[model samples]
Target: MENHNHTALISKLLTCVAACENCATECLKEEDVKMMAGCIALDRDCADICSQAARLLQRNSVIAHQYLLLCEEICRLCAAECSKHQHQHCQDCAKACMECAEACHAHHEPITQD
Candidate 1:
């Protein structure tokens, strides 16, 4: 991938990571924490995957492309879950996840085995 592309994708991934983390933290503070369990779990999973994807992209790892595919999937799932909530943090996280998913989809490249 090109340097500029990598930078942009990494930025999106990191942004998604922050959004996911924040959403999870905020969800825990909601009055009905049990009701937000699914959202919280997806948020944490999305954050972890996005963080890893960003790191792999930063180092130009050969597996980054493949890993991004997984990241995109997780982002979409997270977005869907977040969109179901009315909280401001959840809405923000949904937007971030959707953007990150789009970025990952746009940047996807065929993986070549060494």
Candidate 2:
């Protein structure tokens, strides 16, 4: 991958991590925490995957592309869950996840062996 493409995708992945963490924190503060359980769970999962994907890509790991596929899937799921809520944080998270997923998809390529 080109340096520019790596930078762009890594930036999006980091942005997604921040958004997911913030959304999860804010959701916990909501009065009906029980109702936001799904959102919170997804947010955590998305954040973890995004962070891992970023790290793998940063080091140019052989499996990074494969890992990104998983990241994209989790981001889409998180976006869907966040979109179901009316909170501003949820909306922001949804937008970030969608963007990250798009970047991941655009950058995805056939896995190469070492």
Candidate 3:
């Protein structure tokens, strides 16, 4: 069960990283980059944290629960930020962040149990 949860969570985290990266790149291309500064910053932060969470999960870290909780919170914040924009990339990133957060939440119990 833990293996299944880890696998799914890692997949979601990777998806989130990709989405966030793409969103940040798109934000850079916007005419008013300053207006998208917050979104861009959040995208980078979300991607980095999600990547770190995936790595820790891969290692079966004892502190995985704490990392997952942090990842979930960051993902939620990034999603909220992306949701305020109308661009396709932002919209897509928001969807991925939500998915990652949901998967992280699902995997929380097993990590906390042990």
Model 2: colliding residue pairs: none
lDDT (0 to 1) per candidate: 0.93, 0.93, 0.91
Q: Candidate 1 has what TM-score?
A: 0.92
- Tens-place lDDT per residue, model 3, 7-75, is 777889999999999999999999999999999999999999999999988887777767888899999
lDDT of 2 at 12: 98
Tens digit of per-residue lDDT, candidate 2, span 1-114: 434348889999999999999999999999999999999999999999999999988888767887888898999999999999999999999999999999999877665567
RMSD to the true structure for each prediction, in A, is 1.7, 2.1, 2.7
lDDT of 1 by residue, 3-114 (tens): 5448888999999999999999999999999999999999999999999999988888778888888999999999999999999999999999999999999877766677
Ranking by TM-score: 1, 2, 3
TM-score of each: 0.92, 0.92, 0.90
For model 2, where is the 10-residue window of minimal lDDT?
1-10
Instruction: Please report the candidate that would top lDDT against the real structure.
Output: 1
